[model samples]
Target: MERTRRSTIRSLAALGAAGLAGCLDGGLVGSVRERGGDGDESDESGDGDAPDEGRGPPTADGSRHLAYDLETLREESLSGGVGTDGIPSVENPTFVRIDEPTLIDDVPVFGVARGGEAKAYPQYVLVHHEIVNDVVGGDPVAVTYCPLTGTAQGFERGGTTFGVSGQLVNSNLIMYDRATGSWWPQMLATGIDGPMRGGTLREFRVVWTTLGEWRAAHPDSLIMTDETGYARRYENDPYGLYAPLGGYYADEETLFPPLSDPEEGHPKSVVVGARTADGAVAFDKASLLVERVLSGTLRPSDEPVIAVADPALSTGYVYLNPKNVTVEPDGDGYRVGGDGVGGAAESEGAVDADDLPLERVLAFDAMWFAWAGFYPETGFVGDHTGAGYGR
Candidate 1:
């Protein structure tokens, strides 16, 4: 996975009908070790204070807000003309490539879909994996991916401070084909759920290099979102019924902590979701909390939203969401490609409570990918590593 800082947000609006569990307090076996506790059978004790036991709302210091410039992050990767292959093309696209295509288990990865198409998920769409540990304050959160509501503009603290939470997840910016307005979703699941069917893969279209430019042009386009009413929303999903699609997982200690004050006494960055000695996987609780936003319980108006920042090159330590992204003079932030996304603009659409196709959409995640992975004749796993991975 591409290395970046760890940052995050908190919400549970995607669970729909699943009743918010109140503050995500279920402690994980990993959190305990990070807090100077035990990571083994001790977690089985079910102590209310366990890291896997979930946490309460954040405090004043724990909340944050974020904003960025637009032009700075906008780099047009596409030529000034349409593709020679007759496929759609966006102005100055910033395509994300997935290297080394093959079967993670058995599923064919192919390539990924850009932005703007029905069903955010497409065959071979690369995935981003982010593990959250700490936020602005000494709080914890988790990093999760969903394609339903689209990425939140940013996180907030104390109800007003907004923080950036896009880069690390890589699901924030979405692509839109200037030719066809069809919106294609990226595939989050890697393992072969089953064979690709006819219409199942038709919703996606291939676009040339320009993933970044497309996002810059259509600021309204959403990349990923959080879950708001997942339990009930996915209860009837065909994927969920046949093979469970979206859900939560708790791992070992957080490699990164998304610290509010990186310069202060903070933990160093580690590979996200990496396993430590003793066979335990490193992770963060803050990431899980942010993911709960898809639980149908979090609302857009919720106060003190939590978030993390993606460190440069998987340093592992997570920073507070607003703390990580340093917007440039133009109000935009910088990533590897110097592409920055402005604050999220409100999308004009009514939630289709009953029309969910993939279980992740119900959780509000955005999707995007490079054109190399969109070919109908291509197999899973091409030249990109983003496929089958999670952000």
Candidate 2:
């Protein structure tokens, strides 16, 4: 597959003294040196601090892992081209209202909204700068995108900041925190190395959708501008066109092997997964497209979970099914209220008829192989069956 071929080429290109000289001229090695550092001087951890002690293997509840072991995580992955701060993060980024004639309608963007504040981060911009440290809804948030994994997520960083660690585990971007100098895998959201090892990050929902759909949902939303301090081609996508899902993203193979074997589903199939205190569940995107709404009970606790697919955004949200409300496709939005409240409009305001709002559980979208590799025993809620790891 194209993905494997790309990986082989990159691996071969990183070998030998001639390859080292070539890299020095310009390539992955040079890029890593240019970007690999303690980030800004202000954020540097010059003080001597020992790395965190290693822990036991990941739990069997599909919550954790022992992949490559924490001690060897840094050395296990490719290093030359993966440069820290190589893709400079946009600090205190500027945004314009959605009605402004800056961005086209069809361009793909990651949309996030909270406390009435909404913003869009374009894929073209994120493809270069994978991390954006910005404040939203009076909270410090980091908007991150991994082109290789096709994962876009929002993380609450408290008062600290995050930078690209110039590393990849399972072909996914690894991030480092400025305060603790700890390494965090983007999808896992846990610290694997340094002072903050075993710590978890608070995540927020980021809708992966086109600009047109986001604008319709949030007319008053703000869009990121090209006023970024760095100079580069904003119109050009280094990973290929994503609006139609072509290029590297469309391939069914991965650039690097994952720590755990991928046993179920296609390598590139998209799935919306949610993890609770008990276990994790993954809803197939293809199945969601057909059913619109899927309801199931998570393992170990039998806690009810609901997945509602939004075709307009090309994303799905997983929420705890506490109210037991049946969801159906209603015009542009969804009628999530009780049975009697048929086709109720969100503006009509009948969502609170039961005196309880739908509690949203944290969830994010990932490729099937990445998801299965991380949570091998995860339950599936669509056409695919649950096949435990190393099948």
Candidate 3:
């Protein structure tokens, strides 16, 4: 997947937190007061109905440890100014092929492929709606993006859709399940203030890459269209831009204060992170794109995990490398052979960066601040920031 070179764009405009939040504050607060109210509902009780086992999204056997307790998280939650459902989820999203004129090569998009079905959710379109409740490869899924935290993720939605809860904690979007009505912080995915408390939702990887890179890798993919029922300025971004970097994305300030603050790197520096029930690891995305391979260890156990860059998609993949197999850059692919793993120590062959002979851990791109706020003790590996690979 040879991707086209992307020209970085400069910040188109400077916006303060007040200005940014103002764009959304109370705008359409009532028209959509339709769902949960301003998230200020006096329900600190977490008594939302416990839906039938299979009626909600699939839950993980275990979840990445949260640094804070449920009560503390609830205490930290705040409104994003918009009322519930204010930022609507696209219930009946429509997608089109590459033939669409707006599907340009350098445009940003989040790519997800499953069961032979591939879809590209354009960042411009998603920033306006945040969550797109759609089916892919016949499986119900929710594709969500948070402008404030700079994260995009996918989740399995068994029998219910996810809607924005119009709340923020750690400066991350909080999502609520239409079925159990559980409040889930987008980055955490685990229920915090509802019946689903402590339950982690199943997640899928989302590649934050340019449209050209994705189409090159998945040419026959369908891309989200602005045909969404809502009318929005898909071309405008209230927080900031990314191509050249501008606005809140390039600034050091936060719209809402985070739960925890760590001064490791630029708050908005992008890191490709992967987390499991045991721990989390973050690889400086920029460094991986250049260095090709960055190594780190999970906390407490010192379990080794390596990240490999996929030049084709301008993204990276994390793998559990207990054997510490040697993975080196080979043209656009990678070579894995060492410790008597993939092959003899002296033998090596090119393999796609996405598929090593080791266990692949789902990883996605996120801002450094947001990753640290949630996984405060996460292992970080990169020359772009401070430490390489623990609390």
Residue-by-residue lDDT tens digits, candidate 3, 26-73: 111001101111111011112232224446665654345556666666
1 versus 3: better TM-score goes to: 3
lDDT assessment of candidate 3: 0.71
**Residue 137 deviation, candidate 1, in Å?**
41
Model 1: CA > 4 A from native = 1-66, 75-302, 305-391
Q: What is the TM-score of each candidate against the true structure?
A: 0.18, 0.73, 0.84
**Candidate 3 clashing pairs?**
8-244, 9-243, 9-244, 11-246, 380-389
lDDT of candidate 1 over 77-112, digit per residue (tens): 111112221211111112222222221322211112
Q: How far is candidate 2 from the true structure (C-alpha RMSD, Å)?
A: 10.8
Any residue pairs clashing in model 2, and if so which? Answer: none
What is each predicted model's overall lDDT from 0 to 1? 0.18, 0.61, 0.71
Model 3 residue 11 distance off true place after TM-score fit, in angstroms: 19
The window of 10 residues in a row where model 2 has the poorest summed lDDT is 17-26
Model 1 — TM-score against the truth?
0.18
- For model 2, what is the C-alpha lDDT against the true structure? 0.61
Tell me the spans in candidate 2 whose CA falls farther than 4 Å from its real position. Answer: 1-80, 297-302, 322-358, 383-391
For model 2, how many clashes? Answer: 0
